[model samples]
Target: MNQKLLMAIYFYPRGGSSQVVRYLYQRLEKKWSSALYSGSLGNKGLLTNAETFYRPLNVKSLDYTTAHTAWQKGTNPFDTENPMQASLEDRINVPDTLMARLSPEQLAKQIQSWRHLFSKELLEPALAHLHHLTPMHNAVYELWKKTKIITHLHGTELKMIEYIRSNPKLPFGDWWIEKMIENANMSNLIITVSPHDRDLALELLSVPKHKVITIPNGVDIEIFKPTTLPDKVKMSYWKHWLVTDPQGWKPNHNPGTIRYTENDLKEFYNDDGSCAPILLFVGRFTTFKRINVLLDAYSIFKSHSKQNAPLIIWGGFPGEWEGEHPYEFARKRSIDGVFFSGWRGHDDLPLGLTSSNIFVAPSVREPFGQTYLEAMACALPVIATSTGGPASFINTEPGKKTGWLVNPDDPYSLANALQEAVEDQNLRETAGQNARDYIERMYSWDNIAEQFTSTYQYVLSHK
Candidate 1:
């Protein structure tokens, strides 16, 4: 019989972790049977539709909406009230007013309360189903107990709990820390996406090194490769994205709140009617992403550089960002040739990267810069920070430069790198080819799947 692996994650298929899970599930199915246990917020849009995205993989969505509603009405999960209701509010939609007013302590307590109820109502059922599959014989039960349960950590959860633990002033800090530690210890093998995250896991959760595995996220090279679209077709793609499917948003606004005009198209195209050298930034507008720093660098580069290359901002999930908004900073500085494409699904990212000239994201201490790989796979030269996973792959040598790697949080360094990338087309193309070659050899999902298979084999055999 094939080994059964259960992958449990709190959120539905939306973020980087879900993407990693989806790829791994596809690859792992060749050797082992697996199931996905995840919490659904009930949106099920193009982005959140795991059933379609992870097609053929057995996916069990623990609907948070139904569970939360049950908690609110004091209805037990065991009691029959059609407990897994299909239509309900998304659990992520906490009222803005309530969120803004909660103190750190109050917020932590509220989250802990929700997490407790969610575990009982959602997680327990999923785990119970797996348990039911095991035979009750003592030897078989012991062997089943040895079944490797891989808990994948994507840095955010580790950082949040660590922050609370280190800062004693936060309410329920100890409680949250203890809970996190318990969860970490429960896992047979803990997988972290980057070395930075593995280090954080060791420091924050006190997990033994033997139990932890560092596996960098992989890209689907087949999907994120350079496309051979005709110039006219490329122009149509630009029109469809910038004009037809506008996703740019304003501060505290819903997606599609900000849009572009036909005049905006001129900013992205050259006088010869071809797309200009587009510098792309893809990721959330979180503080650590240092989007303001990128803007500052772009502003400086634009002042001195002759190239009218546009910097296209490709992502910022609706109403979710920290520090100054990129649009606000751009407007304040009067930065030109800066376009926001808003939040888009991963399926649309390949075209976005293929159409762009450079991939730039100066995120500090990023767990693993998956976008960098995607951009590289799409044959775009990258500009990344020195402190994160990008450093592991991006070649920044003097002559054989695959991309530019600048100091974290330094606007001038990033500006110089951006200027260099914009000025030299030969360097961009040469480095882009190198980037594509490197991804094909090292970071493709096929290779990454093999790595996971090896890790899983080791974990299972030892257990």
Candidate 2:
């Protein structure tokens, strides 16, 4: 087996890309000796703390904790000794600079910082599995020219490149665009999270088709599998998340800005014995996520349906957003049922999914919906858009349908799907069962790992 060095320039469990790194490594360990070099932030115990999250593994991190502290101290975090890497998406306040916003000098700092990180590590792995396209790409090229590389695109980079290409005059647009292509060409193998993403890699990066391969992110069935939670226990969890120890954030504020009262818990369940069906949406509040659509649909669904259900909006990193905050959007519309759970660790996801009856996210162009699989594994009927990653796998056929795939960006379609899911509990139950079955048969981590193993071998031999 080939020795491997898995590298991602992001903190663990931040998003699906990070989750992919964790799950893939666990699966890869039996076949290869691997070391993880990831970007980390926060103190030792937090999820941003890489050593805590990727424990019991050989892990080294480029600590961004200092940069975070610098930001808190009202200094330029980007000018700190260990600067945070620029993000693909443009975000409001917080540490890291956006790639589009990065000046030539600032861009050089990012590459220099990553190079310093690479030099400090005693990494001698036979191959490097690098995640996302960044200044780290240039850093690697500068340090280890002969190192075998497998460049993994989690879909965000492609989206960023697309946005930059559309508006050609965007700052450093030409430079970054050409840089990504050069970075991609240097790789021996390119792995994408979905086939749709693979196509984008070919067109956007202008890399050869043979160089690009689609390997979808996997679901950890052991953790995400369905288990019916008792109402009292479910209510306790919801109370902790929504009322006590709340993390629900608002625009220009830290988490817990959108806390709920004890009386507000009534929306989670009806007066009758049966629990009020929870409509769950889990992801970052990026522009493409189209969370506004979910809020609109939820409002419409509540307006029509006598049986009310609360829409639990979960999972966005604190103080990071693309547009108007979801809380702000729901607030302006006087949306009553929508509740923000803020961002929680991966362990909370299974419980959240099992407690909710329907998993709804109307993302316009979701790269590959990792949360959808996690929700499916928990046996919840999912309502996703008809475009992008969800469209590729969400089968709505007569006997094999697992979830409802509505037209993207259309609130009414989502509202109708939401209505249908809540009303038809029997069909919902069947779909949930089907969703779990599909994940078990198709998207397990072990299966995805096998694909990576074979792909890795081919690259090694050719190189």
Candidate 3:
């Protein structure tokens, strides 16, 4: 039998990292047998089912709650010592009853205990049979000491550590930082999604430069490619997404609370009844994403521009946001021509991009703006901040520009870019085409998968 590749992550099918794992596994399955181990919140719907989310790939859910009980029962659930015929599902449970009641400190300790047991009982025994072990985050580095390990960073944990360090009053900040550094040091290879993150890992985690590799996130060009949807179909999409199946949540309100009326759709069309220019922003409403800053800039742009452009704020996980709720902020400022499309699955993003005119996200220090690539693939010109990953691709040159990269956190700069993009229809079309061409040539997921496979082979051969 071929040696199996073990992939582990602490999250379910939610973030960009999960998508990366899914895509890589799809491409690599032809080359090697693989199993994915991930955390489960117990929901058995299409969204939560590992088999459904990662179709045709072997998936194992590690219920830490069940593993915790098995630990107390004095029987190693992952033990191959007795050679029993128990299936992985038979040993795992859906609900984490004990974990739900724990305090923050207790929860941390419980996670640590689970990791220790997982490393010792499951990972250690499987090391000999495994050709490579890849974990999406560094928290599991200690688990694969005997195996060739590739540790991937998606930039959140590093940003958390940096924030914690800057604010020393944060509890256990120093200890967490030290633990992250130790994990990075122990890993055989470290891979981050952006060059900015690579530099941060080298500087903050103190990892050697040669040990780290920068692999930017990629998009599904096949899914996100530019195509014109019929007017009726496009309007139906906008209505269904904004009215029939609303997912936008207001601060301290449940999902779908922020619904749209017939009057709201008027702004989406021009005086001549044509589709108005639509500016889209997709991401979590986190502090660093600067959703409020984008709102401020949009308000400024609307005041100065003659065109009727509506800004569509597409995503924020239901009922979860930092600082002021975007809807409340908009209301307080009386900002018109701004619509919140709510949070939807990534599968629907192509429709959103294709139906829109431009993609704008004013996030400073964005780890890697994967949405920008997705939008670019759909031939939508991008407006992004200059500090992080988007800066690497978004060109600001006059005649040969793919998109605009403005100064981070500067509402005036973003507003200026918005004004320029909305006013010049020719510039928008040219930049959109250029954006599509660039992403096709460089950032397609097939190309990214090949790069990942080569890296895996290199690690396996060397180790």
Candidate 4:
């Protein structure tokens, strides 16, 4: 008989954590009898359809819960009195907050530690805001019925501020150690994408060393391939002459003409395009993603380089928070030779990767970075931080291994590594090949599926 496995995770699939979960689901479908996926697309970001990944395992329907919307009527899995819906004061679903599940004293002590943040001024407003964002109980309850719940933790840096406020004098205050610990303790199968995460989990969360599973993120190697178009994808004057009034760029300028297609990239010619190496940075524009650090590193690289100044391609989502993100810097500072393609889906990812010489993932607090693997799958060498998940599996041996792993916060270090990767074509090619080989051997979905299949069997057999 097929083993029943229930997975629970918050957030949409488009996010880093869910993306890993999605990968696992794809790999381990046959071994598990049933699977459950959860979360909302409205505020949780883009989520893939359940049918796309879960239906083959005989999953009935994805149990969805939104913090912004009301939950539909249901039998409830948590078996709580407050079912159909819940106000912020009525329920708290986060596993970390489930410490409220403890004795009143435990809950009180946890709250007392945060009594400062809730002082006469901030507490009421924060509560008001939180209450306003409270999700429905029916949604949470339905999620509890799943056989295996898989939640990928994204936005660790953003989440750190609140964690610090709650437990200030806590050890490793600068890092999200406690949060990692909480997840490591709570998750039946805590799969971290990075080795740093695995290390931090063991150190801070008090989880047994064996409980934490390290499954680095991956790329679809079959798709993304290298290209040899010297003049096809050059930056044109039209891209630089953008009209920015918040209404966005003007449409009459042959918007389609500016859009680069595979055919266009393959055939387009450039008068001055003498093939400057193209370097790419892909992922969200956030403090944790460290777009600013990347820009600074690029600037540093440019200053140091004497010849063949590399062209930089910055892709992915815009910053949701305030302040000037990389895209803003690229647009405002008129940073020449840099192109911003905003965000592109997986369908277009391969083409984009093929167009670049190297990929840089400079995230300050990435929970799991799949972009590096995707770049490698495309046969492009990656330069990433030795933090978060992507760095966990990276085997950087200069020109001998996958990619270069440098310190994230140090822009100078990043610049040095980036400079080397961009300048040496042979090193880039060899590292890229090694990266593809590593992903095929360890990070690919096939191996991940087998590991997950065993994990599911273990969880089911014991439970």
Q: Give the TM-scores of the predictions, in the order they appear.
A: 0.83, 0.95, 0.85, 0.66
Better of 2 and 4 by TM-score: 2
Cα distance off (Å), candidate 3, residue 443: 0.8
**lDDT (CA) for every model shown?**
0.70, 0.84, 0.72, 0.50
Model 2 lDDT, residue 276, Cα: 84
Backbone clashes, each candidate: 0, 0, 0, 11
| Ten-residue region with minimum lDDT total, candidate 4 | 125-134
lDDT of 2 at 226: 86
- Among all windows of 10 consecutive residues in model 1, the one with the lowest summed lDDT is 128-137
The candidate maximizing TM-score is 2
| Residue ranges of candidate 2 with Cα displaced over 4 Å | 10-13, 120-123, 396-398
Predicted structure with the largest lDDT when compared to the true one: 2
Summarize candidate 2's per-residue lDDT along 291-408 as a digit string, tens digits.
9988988899889998878899998888778778888888888999888999998878888888788999899878999999999988998899888888877884568879999988
TM-score of 2: 0.95
Between prediction 2 and prediction 3, the one with superior TM-score is 2
Question: Which residue pairs come into collision in candidate 1?
Answer: none
Residue 16 C-alpha lDDT in model 4: 53
lDDT, candidate 1, residue 11? 54
Candidate 3, 1-463: lDDT as tens digits: 2355666666546566677777666776676656566654334555545555666667765443344345447654333221111111111222222111223454344345435535533324221211111222333444455566677788876776667666776455576567568767777788888888889889988988888998877888899999987767788898998888888888767779889986788888888998888899998777888999999999999889878998999988665566788889999999998888887877798899999999999888888888899999999999998898788778834566898888989999999999999889999989999999989999998899888778877776775
- The lDDT of model 1 is 0.70
